[model samples]
Target: MRSNRFAVMRGTALATGLLIALAGCGGDSDDKGGDSGGQTLKGVTIEVAAVWTGAEGAGFKKVLDAFSKKTGATTRLTPTGDNTATFLQTKIQGGAPPDVAMLPQQGVIAEFAKKGWIKELGPEVQAAAKQNFSKVWQDFGTADGKMYGLYFKAGNKSLVWYRTKAFQDAGVQPPADWAGFVKTVQTLSDAGSTPLAIAGGDGWTLTDWFENVYASQAGVEKYRQLSKHEIKWTDPSVKQALKTLAEIWSKPNYMAGGAAGANSLLMDKAVTDVFGSEPKAAMLSGADVVSANISETKSKVGTDALTFPFPKTGAKPPLVGAGDAAVMLKDNKGSQEFMKFLATPEAAAAWAKAGGYISPNKALDLSNYPDDVQRASAKAVIDAGDDFLFDMSDLYPAAFGGTKGAGEWKRLQDFLKNPSSVDATAAGLESDATKALKS
Candidate 1:
């Protein structure tokens, strides 16, 4: 969803070395998870809610259809758009919450579980989750020592997608560190190419930018502490990260059509700018799903649109990530059965075959993904094991991080437009974070 994007607020072990050590960790699995134990739902209809729509919504529907075929139950997907947390709350208040809901933000999962609005999964679902997901993922879904959610979709938010020809034309390779990255940007701009395509219109994209930089500059421990709000947003680490971001953002010519132009471009448009017929910029940074957005353009994925990890900003770069977890909101025969099905590799593979998806399930075959680029990306997450950091904004309360024209989204957009306002931005973010997290 544009509003919240990817987040991992759980204080866990996340480091750059994890990604390096796990590069060759992907392998095929024989456990396809096809056994259903003779469970059947002939006349049941299950309702699922999530913020996925468009191609993402369609891909998930295919997965649901697979579930229906395996068990003979009808499945319906309710697209909640960008404001899923608020929408689910309203549904609950009206006594009309869906049978199962895919919570994208962990903060919402905690809030809902604390309010007793969500129910615990049955033993069958729990066992399957333990088998399919890593301990870090399982830990993320657990609150107060009880597992209430199962993460199905996973994201690697550290990639920077760019056009192959653009890099060749600019005579620059993807840089490995922040200093090299800034030099590369300047080279591209000096060669008369817009150096970056930032999706400023979608504020969550800016949050992604900040998260990657913050996690890289601040060590994983500090990143986790700040994510849990143990430290204020005005901490010196936050200022350092903002200044690091300003290296590129503060320069108007380093971006396509300048800051004003970037402020009007959405996620897809930002991708198109670099991969379109007449490319406008050299690179766009975000999650692996940016590959799907490129498919809508003139680029040919692995051949034309290539990706490199976000440049390192510290002693080691952090692997920032995001995902959606399936939680039971209204327990019943259908909901229980569906929740159990979601924990299987079959469920992940079903949507993965439709492309534009990555599964966190360790048992899922890497071949299930549609392309080499995506396969590599998914392997990075699977290999990282427990050493993963989620998107920081996604870990915050929705009022502070998820809302549009308010909270982190608006404040980040303001900072992106005027990178010189670091002091004011940090103060504003701290104020907003305090109110939202406390409320």
Candidate 2:
């Protein structure tokens, strides 16, 4: 069996380093040791591939710099552009794959592991994960009873972003449960504000909405069964979640422009409609990237802009989140050492200090984060402990999870347009999921 080690932690939002930058991993000269923990890792060169770009890429390099110095190693950084899976596959086929790769999806990891293309993490890395991370994260790299990945960096999806001024003006408290959530939207709607900003034009946004609600309402096992196609989409649990979605979606006045204006809003526009001037929508729910959008607006985050966890509506409202998991393709002394470093709080601390990053490693000090928004995102995971689940679309076959027409994207889009036919929507979803997973 092919072995792989997965490591995922939180860092800069939407970091896709489209191009590579050659730079020395920065640090004081004295700390660059020839041997770490009595392991002589002198003069070893490790190759790394990732999609992290912009601030995210820079932050990761800071961590790499630390790893480089600690073990007297150098790294060749390769940016995977938009698709790490495709990039890694091409390299492997050519017998020139990098020593390690930061894979963005569990589905890709599973596929690679099945093809005997990945190497399992070293014992030291696994030990750190057992002690530092929650089980949900530990499982990110594990398949069929063997550990393969480390979920190092995570992004919270359960967060509900809102204009602080709007909530206060309407005398509405951030909701704690699903009932309160619906009621708050009604209150905001009555206050002459768009209660929700939904981006229907972009199909993936619709999938995100459905995943969050479905995971929260249907609970983890059902979510797992559905994600893997073990349970049909037409199951009652899924239907119940769909019906629950309509509770707010069907109420025309509750959405921006009464649902008629959903498609044109787009993701960025949908956010600006809420956080921008004279705000159109009062609330929105999405991953931490929402903060990046908040930064673009004049609203001061944690003040004019704020967030709270998605309301609990199931047996365990595990925080719905997403992250990139680092995995090994080549098992060697150098790559193993780097993986161990990544598993340390000290390593994540470097990225955290760079801002726009969060660490699921409980060993990481929350005070290390630069702002309240990041701390809040990290805290939700800490608060949920081992109860969180990855983004559903990320864990599924692309055919069902992707934005192609007639996939989960279109199904959710259709449901949003005519939410009353949730049964039809659910049936269509099951049919597609079955075909996709089987194929």
Candidate 3:
């Protein structure tokens, strides 16, 4: 049976005066949805922009399809791929922003709002948001006292996935604190197994690792400052966190193929390879979505596999994650209708039923998920509520976060390749942030 074997979850709410006002505005929505004021929305084709591709894209389309069926309106999805900031600027400056953009960050949504390029949620959308989501979930979309985005999909990136039998055989239990975690790593390594499977080659994965550790190690206020470039990366807290990360990185045999081998492993190859039989690694620190991903790579979700929280490495366990948010740019009936639909329990249920989708909306019944494992991950995020932080790198400027070859991704990847270079890495990150956020 799977427990929290290494993961149980619960959450608290973080709300603002504006969101507090929103909280009292409505109640939870029904799973099937409410009236769409259909006459105004019928036959109007709304354009939506998002970064989803492959199965993710396909699953989201089903939700859009459900909206079409409900409101008698057509929806077209425009794939933004990885360049959200540039693509958005190009569209907005050209006077042709999509009716809606499924922004990847609250910070990005705020940026759009600041430039007068997006619309605040209309009354219906705002009311639906209050009815369907938690206050903290709503806060992710709020900036400057206005709600400009509606979170639809989310993931909790704080779990450690392990080869069940390996852990059992090695006499290792999922760890709850840093000391136990290190001991567990040593146990796995001493027992002739690679202790950790790191997705180092994929720069973005490296950033996730840094963010999780930093948030826990350095605290949220510093996390906020570093993310916004309000504080220098060379601060003592940043180095202290790096030292903590170095403990794991410095251990040669703890990871598959030593440091060099781990550095060569790409994100796509990391989990599947690690979870493969005759496994190279006994554990993986990954997001909630990895539950499904491990299965795709032939690892059983709750049997061959199990998970635990990634231990309390600092003041507390911090939930670091990412999500997709719906923001209206056109202010038209179709756009308003679409945003309203996204904030419903029914909209969430549609995607959850389609598989590989998790709604932050508290109104969605856990029964809609694929299985208990999926349910637990969803509940974990819901329970963590207000204490969680968005994926740090994703919450900042492009040059500092999501761009392919630069920013946190590249710098951290470089640091991992040589753990002794933390000082250099910290300096480089600080320099990049200084340049990127110089409005």
Candidate 4:
């Protein structure tokens, strides 16, 4: 079971927004009108809160319904809006927190454990997890020597989504190394296609690139060390990673419209530009972003495009996508049984079928997926071993995460405008990171 300290703190931060939104959504009215007589599953009801909204929320409902049908448990889902961290905090504090919460951000799982709000799932949940999931899933949710959450499904970001036809038209092979990758980009650019579709406007997207490059250049352990502030950003490996990003952004016809204007392109639009028949661009680096975009645009996955792992220097591990885990907050027979259900192969399969993601439970087969790319992505997640986790932004403090969103992306854009600013830019980031850590 994960600890709940972080959830508690996050709840406090999100309390005001949650109250206003809940109040506006007639949540207060529901509280008054609905049976508050403590409805039980069988005779008890379990509340589950998630950040997913719209289609995502609907997809989750399918899985929850399946769980309910099998276990005779009643689940009430509350769409906490876009600010999940805040919404989770609010729900947990009001004495009406969900029994099982789907935490989108994996980095804060440990922090939540440190707080008392979350409870560690004891022997029963662990036994079920051991039977259902791969070792990687178990390792990811284990913190401070205790298991806090059950890994549900994951996506891989170390992928470059490209149009198959576009690559063939340019007469290029998928990049196998950093040099080859750059050459492929140059070839694509020379052929009149934007080499990379960079989305600078959404700051978090930029952070994904940083993590990809960092992991590729220095491997996952070093990347983890960098995140914990154990290694200086001025370290050669760190500088090399940043330089790689700068080079990619600086290339002619590489990033769409150079650095200054690249910020105008959102991730989805950038991806669409690459895969569309008109072929405005050649490739985009992102995780399940392409899948989500294609689903939204009603485009086909394998027919529209495919993805490959980012080329790197060293022995490359499997690329990882973002994933969510179910953390137990209030421990009781009901919560324990619910968590055990979550760690089952049935639950894993249900989640994969509904969400179109790879279940962290290795015992479940992925042959049912329609898209070859998604199946390949699932293989990558399975192969990533214990190194799997989400992007760096979610791993760092909110302030630092925001800085990466706007500050670092902006710095890269500025450097693209003037390559000579590389040293200065790197220095500035290192300084800022140092300060952020100190504070």
Please, what are the lDDT tens digits per residue for candidate 1 over residues 82-173?
Answer: 78898988999998999998888877778888999999888999999888889989988888788899998889999988888888988999
Per-residue lDDT of candidate 3, residues 75-185 (tens digit): 677756466777878998898999998877666777788889889999888888887778887888998999998998887777778888889889988888787898889
User: Cα deviation of 205 in candidate 2 (Å)?
Assistant: 3.4
What is the per-residue lDDT of model 2 for residues 298-412, given as tens digits with 9 covering 90 to 100? Answer: 8777788888877877755547777777889998877787888889998899888776566789999999886888787888877777677777777776556643455787888
Per-residue alpha-carbon lDDT of candidate 4 for residues 293-404, written as tens digits (9 for 90 to 100): 5555434678757777877756774364566788877787667867876776666666556534566677768775546777777777776667675556555443344332
Q: Against the true structure, whose TM-score is highest?
A: 1
What lDDT does each candidate get?
A: 0.81, 0.74, 0.74, 0.64
Give candidate 1's total backbone clashes: 2
Q: What's model 2's lDDT at 204?
A: 64
What TM-score should be assigned to candidate 1? 0.92
Error of 1 at 145 (Å): 1.7
C-alpha-based local distance difference test score of model 4: 0.64
TM agreement with the true structure for every prediction: 0.92, 0.83, 0.86, 0.81
Worst 10 residues of 1 by lDDT: 7-16
lDDT of 1 at 166: 81
lDDT at 72 for candidate 2?
60
